[model samples]
Target: MINKKLIAPFYERLSLVLIGILALGFIIVQGKEILDPLMFGFLFAILLLPVSGFFEQKLRMPRSASSFLAIILLVAFVGGVLYR
Candidate 1:
């Protein structure tokens, strides 16, 4: 009772399900080892370093103050996006 006309649609649906299952399995298996925490730390440190130095060299504010300012700016930007 299998209709020949239905074969292409059936294969297309099967291919999509297979690809999704593979992607889900990969994420479940490698979510931690493949992703980065130290990479984030390094990037954040590099970004703030210049801003902190700008304060110390030009404005004469302490590193801690510059870091706080950067964090506040980041929070404001993120909050604006979320609110909108």
Candidate 2:
């Protein structure tokens, strides 16, 4: 026979997990404006890593120059999309 007592702890743990998830979702929603640009910059930097490495390694560009080029390209790309 199944015991109610045995399942009680599992239900308590599940409810706590659900509540934590809801709280995290609420915080993310409230902070979207601040989080959005930060997330975009993170993703954009990740996308540019390989290109920056190429410029630095293959083209013999300096670290600062390669990074600057990557940022310039990112801005240009966004501008192009907005312009179109």
Candidate 3:
């Protein structure tokens, strides 16, 4: 036999969790357009990190110089892809 006392709080907590999940989902859906580019830029920066580090360490370039060179390399690579 199940106890009546334990069931009430359990149901209450479960409902709260479900409501929280639904609310989070609603917020993400509402902000999709604004969030998409920010996420893309973040991933793009991640992709550039290794190439930037190589320029900074092996080539002994300054941080800003290396990063700018990395951006140039990225542009050139992208342009070549588009051309071909």
Candidate 4:
């Protein structure tokens, strides 16, 4: 049979990992309202970075103008989906 002493430490480590994961999940749930929009905006900006670069480099738009255009495009796309 396997040594019980060796198995005990393995179970202890596994339980610690499980507890840490549960704690993180609880914190995320509690902060969801504030975190959700911040995360969404972060991801949205990442998604738009390339398009904004294209407008600035290829289309010769200014930095602010390119960023504004990217935002306008996103709004229009979302509006279209909602309208449809």
Question: TM-scores of the models, in the given order?
Answer: 0.48, 0.78, 0.81, 0.73
- Tens-place lDDT per residue, model 2, 32-52, is 999999998899989999989
Sliding window of 10 residues with minimal summed lDDT for model 1: 32-41
Candidate 1 scores a C-alpha RMSD against the true structure in Å of 11.7
lDDT of 4 by residue, 1-84 (tens): 875654558789999999999999999999999999999999999999999999999999999999999999999999999995
lDDT of 2: 0.94
Error of 1 at 37 (Å): 2.5
| Model 3 per-residue lDDT tens digits across residues 1-84 | 976654558789999999999999999999999899999989879999999999999999999999999999999999999995
Which runs of model 1 end up more than 4 angstroms from their true locations?
A: 1-35
In Å, residue 56's CA in model 4 sits off its true spot by: 0.7
User: RMSDs, each prediction?
Assistant: 11.7, 5.1, 5.2, 5.7
Estimate candidate 3's alpha-carbon lDDT, on a 0 to 1 scale.
0.92
Please identify model 4 stretches exceeding 4 Å from their true place.
1-8
Q: Cα deviation of 9 in candidate 1 (Å)?
A: 54
Which residue pairs clash in candidate 4?
none
State each model's CA lDDT, in order. Answer: 0.79, 0.94, 0.92, 0.96
Top of the candidates by lDDT: 4
